[model samples]
Target: MSSYKKLIYFTLLLILLVYSVQILNIARFPSQIDIIKGDSRNLNIFFPFSLEIMEESSDIVKINSTNAERLSVGLKNSYNLESTNNGIAKLKLKFLGIFSIRDIQVNVVNQAYVIPGGETIGVKLNTKGVLVVATSEIQSIDGKIYNPARNAGIKVGDSITMINGIKIKDADHVIQLLNNIKNNKVKIEIERNNASFTTEVLPVKSKQDNSYRLGIWVRDKTAGIGTLTFYEPNTKKFGALGHAITDVDTGTLMKAENGEIMRAKVSSIEQGKKGSPGELRGMFFETDDVLGKIENNTTFGIYGTIYDENKLFKQKQLLPVGFQSEVKLGKAYILANIEGDKVTEYEVEILKLEKQNVPQSKSMVIKITDERLKEKTGGIVQGMSGSPIIQNGKIVGAVTHVFVNDPTKGYGIYIEWMLKEAGIYVNNNSEFAEGK
Candidate 1:
């Protein structure tokens, strides 16, 4: 090829690459805004922040607005932009002591605009804050039976604090460590209500691989929710979210996913602050969903056309695509009709909204606002995924996950996202999230 021609081709390639990268950036923009904005969405089910930091001081990398000015704060420190403030601002730090590793690893660090004193040009700094993590591996057996986990001083319902003195990074790390140390005795730590404890256990050898096994099961992650996806009036059969719930430890989706979807009523919710996220909690299983055929339970939603729809809905209307945009910021509601119960409503607020590149959970935030709701579910507790998020008299999204440290702050997946995964189309009348 001629030199000029080669140069032209290379230049074209460079342009294409730049364009591609720009497109990718655009795709991730909404999620980016979500993290910065925090909990403006009313649902306590979505975690918008990506990065988290564990530090003694609240000094943060301040995030500034494009239109405002900056304050005299130390550079390189984390900060947050006030939605109300036109410029960069830092939140007063609170909470001291050790933070969960999961809370520190979320993706919240990114280039933030810091307008210093009415200057349009702003400096970029990485922000620090708390992130939420979830797990299903908590062990809280009803009766105290002697077992390896217990002998190691591991108590039922005690949250695994750390493994081998190292923080439990994620479900994958926990599994990998357990699988590698087969038959080997290992130390573990746990935390409950701000208190920390430790224990040790020897893994048993598995005939299958001659590797060590801990007869005890542990979990670290999960990401799916379903709303009584279907209900059968007769025989009292009901399905949720049209998908199977999974156990992150085994990397297997529960069959018949026999776990019941309880009514998690929410109580009070903390407002989303600069570093710390909020949560909701309430009681559940005041009713239960009997196990039935496990048809389809994918990332889209849970599915098992139910045997009973009578008790689930006040009146069953062929389900429609729940438009997320119609959801307002405050005084929203939820419809949890799982396990042969009437679709009950709970009060919540859309604290933040980011229709951008959301992670496993969409880029939105919410807080449970109803006291009656809190007393029922421990503030967005488990078995509540797939509860329909309704606002402005429309179905918007389904509850997907909860924040362990702060149950009142949970995560939710946009209904359209779930519908797309389920091969359901968003009709013209349905509102599609902009730039998502």
Candidate 2:
């Protein structure tokens, strides 16, 4: 081949090599990371490229130059970073120890520790207002059929906020307001799909009971049993269930304005089978007892502030939070109360993990490895949702779901998302974990 042909082939090879590195850039480096204070973390860097870490704020985070070592092939593969303080630090990454590649924003947050909860707790949640579950025709006193809510364009999942400008407290409150309405057509304030509007619903006197009826079934409260995930003493806040509490009738997320948690003891357990999910039967230790006030009901879980801390739990076991990146696929233990009020530790294994940049429920796949737990509850039962998963002396996540076909297996949500939902991780860089 001629010199010109050889030069052309080399130029093409160089272009392809550069393009490959640019594509690998997306996989090799993180855009941002959360470093725990006083702990060192290693950053992954591939061969053929050495990153020179320069901390913008040396006081917040310092790159450990001592831990940097040259590979057998004379390439830098990783860098160790120590978070010294609770603040944001900028890191200037370089390629081959010379060329600037990109800048990484580091959030050095204090290592947060909280009490890991395992005791079964009874939950009673009241919706913000009356949630319409169904609509039916009402039998009027004059033998007339009237569907007031349906005809007024109210939906099944709609929540009635007020009746004739009076704030609706519950289903019973709406009934009292409807019966006292002197006008035939009553003004109803409805909240549908996050937007609120007023619609006129005709009130009809029932033929049998002589009571005013709206021809709609509205529910204002729900109750169930779940395991507690965590309680942060610093914030006096607690999170539980690892999932939302939805209305059984309308299948809508119960928007909670007020609710309570109570001490509960597991009574019985139904063994799970393939395609058939089992449940843990529990009852409140004390009737009408309020352990805490439920403030918010969300997809993540139910969050609330526990004012009666002394009545809640016996001095609980505290553990640090393990971020998403810190959670590895290995053996872990979970705290679950299977018999009466006794909480026991069971072994579990993390099968898989997802690179989640955003908050999600299914962050890791977990399976029950302890025979004691499996024989007792047939793996993860219904009420075991918020059982705290502990690994490496940290609270890594909470049990969120169980596989219907494989009862021994289930999914867990990282504690990072739960912390944010519980308002304990507010304004901290500790929750941010970028994609690989």
Candidate 3:
């Protein structure tokens, strides 16, 4: 080939290469970002030949970005974005500081100030209805095996709400309704995945007990211990458990018709080991000393209004919620109560961060680095789920799950999602939010 032809070929290849890098740069950069007012975030673009931060509103978000700053190799271009106001701002990202790539909409939210809670609280959850956990075969009075629930299309993870047009209360209520169901086809209303439906079934009399049975196991209530994550001082709301309180046998995310948060004291510890998760055994009064009434149960955590303000553990320092973008990969501490109503600061290191755009349970991977905590309970145990993760004087996230293979490491959830779910003040302007 001639030298001129070779020059043209290399030029075309260079253009293709530039175009691919620019596209990847655009793809990797997030389309939207949220920042707390008065907090500054350093945005680094790893790709060399991409982006100019063109500020549309300096009052909302001030941009001190360098588009022309030269970096040799393996160094990212630095852009400092400072949030100034409690509103929305649009920052334009351009290619070669001229060609418009896309707009990065910035949500400037007010700092979510909350009291960090590490108090081990007793959670008494009364499910919406009787949760059908399992269907079993029963030896009937006719000397035959039958599963009446399976025959009637009742499956596990179903909520049996009503029987014969009467709203069922609990397992005892179902047993009472079984009397009316004996030898008669009864209409049973069930709720699955938030949709309501009904089925008909005839209860069979058990051979051994001589009692009418549906051959299905169900539970209406569950009680357990969990660490409280945070308490919104202004709203009097609290969030706990970091993740949903699922049924042990069926793994169903429990729907709470009503529940309560009470004071609990850790009695003993079951040390966690590989393939065997440990637990913090605690005791609480069921009928007395109710701290708060549970209003919602979600994948993020359990949330509710606190009736007793004195029950919340008072923290020495203030904690404004750290957004997912602000959470750095480094050392952090979790506020946990391992023994006898005493909240202790345990050192933990953040191993990873998930740049999530939406709400999720696992937001970061963390390891227990505190020797004192490891010696007591062998890392993250069962009742430590909602322990608040504190980093840089902020409530970054909460411990949600434990690694069964390695007891020292576990997953944490972003505190922003929990604050939003609990109806705490996060977005300052609803009108501004809705306009976008």
Candidate 4:
């Protein structure tokens, strides 16, 4: 073939490859989208292609430029969808001249209600058993060092729940069990990475202490203070600590068999500075003011149900939860308790908003703008992790982490995700709904 003819053939092949990519991109959209009733959303198709909504499951949803006689979409490549009622609708999308058909599930749901939390509370967590924090060498009776835990495949972050079919309690309890067993091999039941297994471990007689040793260090409980994010009145569920409570030594998510939320008194404040994060030094009030029980410690936060509703902050009205899509880059406020038991609202500016389709902790970047807060805590401090952020009279998110280099700026988690982690369902149908 001639050189000119060969170049023309190559050009055609490249065009075909581009079109193929567009086709795949259009087909890869999520099959299901959710929206709240009376809300609209914009659905955009990135590539240059035509789309048509062939059928809808119910009359609760309406697509742009759609009529009863025929459903046709123009070559705009983007369309608006509105939910008129609360129901499920199945939309058939015909892409690229009917070359591919994709089904999109549209669900309309009700709006959510939750009480915004800003009180400083104490958190006490007890693991199912003792967590192995480290392994060490034990001097045995024969004047030799033996690492029984390492030899038995027990590593850091593993929870030793049972030994010889008996439940292990605290560190001292494990010591007593080992002393009683002496040098005999015992079955050690452990949980690692959410999986359970058993291994036979032999205890070494320590020459220094004249007792049996496992050559491991374990912890059974952890306590700290954090701000509350919200409380659902309908379910009596509450979420706090916008981030997970991980083990300080091992830096792993702590598995809580049981925990408590109690009132806290701020003793002192260590102001935050560049390259260092400050903290609120507080003491748990030793009273019968237990507010709730922590049942879950998740990546998003800690979730539980309140026992005494009267113990929580008395808000005249509950705040409407805001979805991530509705979060805007502008002025906002964070409710936090920096001083003794008094929750105060501080002004903050939402610097950046991230468009996230999945659940994530840091959804927005916020800066402390309130003069009083800056003077008090020097920006976002350690105990302000779960401070509720309000935007446009709606609870939008919570404070998660502070910027290491700039204490004045920090990351905020979308409140919708925290609510979901707390087992409170929000408007699920807003994911695919497009507004005009």
Clash number by candidate, in order: 96, 0, 0, 12
Q: Score each candidate by Cα lDDT.
A: 0.43, 0.83, 0.85, 0.84
Give per-residue CA lDDT, model 1, range 84-168, as digits (tens): 2121222222112122212211121221211000000001111011011232122223322234664565543345646676666
Stretches > 4 Å off in candidate 1: 1-23, 26-244, 248-292, 308-314, 317-320, 337-342, 356-360, 426-436
Greater-lDDT candidate between 1 and 2? 2
Give the poorly placed runs of model 2, Cα more than 4 Å off.
1-33, 40-59, 62-82, 90-105, 285-289, 427-436
TM-score of each: 0.38, 0.81, 0.81, 0.86
Model 1: C-alpha RMSD to truth? 21.3
Look at candidate 1 and tell me the lDDT of residue 179: 72
TM-score of 1: 0.38
- CA lDDT of 102 in candidate 2? 74
Question: Stretches of candidate 4 above 4 Å error?
Answer: 1-32, 48-56, 65-76, 91-104, 426-436
The numbered model that scores best in TM-score is 4
Segments of candidate 3 deviating more than 4 angstroms: 1-32, 41-59, 62-81, 90-105, 139-144, 207-210, 314-317, 425-436
| Stretch of 10 with least lDDT, candidate 2 | 427-436
Worst lDDT window (10 residues) for model 4?
66-75
- Estimate the TM-score for candidate 3: 0.81
